[model samples]
Target: MQIYNEFELIARLTHGLTTRPDVALGVGDDCALLDIGSDSQLLATCDSQVEGVHFTLRTSTPEQIGRKALAVNLSDIAAMGGVPRFALISLVIPPRFSQEALEGIYRGLRQEAERHQVAIVGGNIAGAGQGKQLMLDITLLGTVRRGQAITRGGAQIGDVLCVTGSLGDSAAGLFTLLHPDGTGAENALTFVQARHRTPVPRVAEGRVLSAFGPAVVTAMLDISDGLSGDLQHLCERSGVGARVFAEHLPLTEEMQAIAARVGKDPLDWALHGGEDYELLFTLRPEKAREVIEAVQAQTGTRITRIGEIIPSGMCLIAPSGTEQPLQVRSWDHLH
Candidate 1:
């Protein structure tokens, strides 16, 4: 058998899978959309965090791990322009796992759930036979008004591409963890590490964008697989291309300082680093300013127009006025 990357494996597994008519959208977008005889469409998404694969107790506390495990799924709901309402958490516990740590993890989960106003209605716990690592699998359910879910398939040519918050902070935070000897300003290190541990899902911003409707917002997704890789997803689904202005990518001074201290390119992290949990979206060129202003005023999230939808070919325009193919060098779980 040949090994496949994460996306290739997903494409292979989801090919020709049977789905019901109630499935409003399926298999490609951030969340599965379903119409269960309600005025609102349901958004469903699930994500899992495996010990050693997604996180380690050595780096992240049990609370942080639990919070992040849920936060990632919340981001998927946000990407779909839905309001998260409920969650089901499944746990795979290894032998000798600390009970106190589990309680701490639940505390974090509760904190995040309260913040998002999502109810944890039910879940399952299972023993991991012969497994040494703990894992949390979460299924999140959300809703959006009928005909209002923002998906990746609705972008149009000349639409403005936008992203919420600064990119690369999570990546920089991970760098500090992996290479602790790399020194930077204390505040910068603290900020980036917090970003890595507990990412803020753009739920409020997503709601604001969804309120604008897909006609104006065009398309949206959360950046989990880096800007370039996730942008590829958006383009493929929308059957459009994009041109990203390298100079326009939002980067924080903290991430830049950390990158400099670690002797890495901040641009690389901003473009290709994964797990930012920020919203990546497109809007009609004419309505871009209005949407940006609305989101900022309503949610206090800065939305930056870093690119535009093009007829074909994804490209990156450098600050020096040079254009080149935008490469996807994002994290691949199965690679």
Candidate 2:
């Protein structure tokens, strides 16, 4: 469904779910309610997962889909250097799907929520008609102390660009599922599948970055789309461009193995293959190692300084030393 059919119902029913005294005004209202704290800042982010678009029933379990639905949004919150505290879920399912599948989805959501110490404040559910696709939508609400939140627009030229975890694994994993010739690369495929099914948000890394200081973050973004696309966002938001040294990209052995077997460009997969759910961010030169080390120790995720933010003319300078304007060629729903 296009969401138009139930738009009115969604609006009409939201008000009765609960009334928060802190909410100045909510639902059917021009804006959401909130009693902004003098010392705290609020953050909100939403993500949507569709059956065929984001995942297919062929390779995904209900729990995997469910966990992914929430993890992706939580990753946004983490990118902002905020602690996710609550969530609102909206699930659309076909009538014929088993109750067990639905519950498994919830189980997955709950598993991530518990792991992240977040509470499911509220949500809505609905049934899709026959032949309709399934979808999961979630809005995660988080909070951070005032002046502590990071943003995409703060990246500065000369700032070192970093990623919290290895790249291309998620993309490689998707490849494995699509082409099972790599099945015997047992360890490799499993790693990729896990990355696809349940990505680890760099929440702790975000927090550690916050403690080190402010404006230390010149720019910040999460890599849900692909590396190339997400860098576009950071560059666009910060009004600056970048150069990713392809050789410097931290690739997992599994990713390399898969890429070699398929004759796929590992660097292309690293640069454009999406859904890594890792953080692509930039920080001041002086604080790079300190913050990278801090975040790695705390998050147990490798933090690689792959390149530097630069002026607009050279969007991305590859390791082969070729310069080309970067494009957002990754996942865009309407595409």
Candidate 3:
């Protein structure tokens, strides 16, 4: 059998793929050129998924892995309330990896790209030595109307803190897969596993929040690195403090059940559980209800007011009305 070179692989994957008008130059170039036009500001972000670190083939399929690698980057664009337009995907392949698996990864990537109107413009692939792990990296480009992109630093002291959809499902999903012992119900197992395998980016909801003009969303970020840790990022950037109401956290019934069965705190999953991909944002105190109603009516995505941005440091407010300092217990590269 004749082995394919990098150019051949690129042609096979990108052939017959759709292209956007703004993408002036695409694959087969040293660098992709994009014509962003006069009305939109560019948005760029990158995320990586590794074989052992992010996933194992034992638990996830090649398609799921590819879809997730792209989804996470889309979540970043969504956090800024932008529309994704193009992507550049990079891969580090083990020598023994099959072309079938490569096809599956591109299939998954195409699935997500088609959904979000994003085009896969360019990327690179490389081979690795024995025992080296597989890795997938994605660099996504997006755009937002000029003077409209939201950031983590704009939150005000009295803004109401909110999150879209439920939290902790992703963490519960990962835990159920990693530790099957004491896990109850096959249906519940599937629910959580599907969540971990295919997390949805809140692209529509983010656009809704951002479309109400600049003042609607005070600050925004996607919860890829756990709510507690990412919230601290927003707080630190805004030079503010925050208080989360523990009781108000939105936890799914399945997540709560799984936590109870495993003797784990659902709040912990909701607070420190990473990879949720839900939007964590703040709105002016008086406009909170109005915006929440509009979001629910338009997107059908649940929005919860879990807390408020304060003046100095972050904490979690217990149901008993006691306040405790919130810690960064989410994933960190180094201890």
TM-score of each: 0.99, 0.87, 0.88
User: In model 2, which runs have C-alpha deviations exceeding 4 angstroms?
Assistant: 1-35, 182-184
Query: Which candidate number has the best TM-score?
Result: 1
On residues 186-256, what C-alpha lDDT tens digit does candidate 3 reach at each position?
88778878889989999988888878655868888889879998898788768899999999999988998
lDDT for each residue of candidate 1 in 1-335, tens digit (9 for 90 to 100): 89998888999999999988888899989999999798899999999899998998888998998899899999999998899999999999999799999998899899899999999999999999999998899999999988889999999999999999999999999989988885698899999999999999999999999998999999999999899999999999999999999999999999999888878999999999999999999999888888999999998888899999999989999999999999999988887
lDDT of 1 at 169: 94
Query: Worst ten-residue run, lDDT, model 2?
Result: 24-33
Q: By lDDT, who's the top model here?
A: 1
What are the Cα lDDT values of the candidates?
Answer: 0.93, 0.79, 0.85
Instruction: List where candidate 1 sits over 4 angstroms from the true fold.
Output: none
List pairs with backbone clashes in candidate 1.
none
Comparing 2 with 3 on lDDT, the higher-scoring candidate is 3
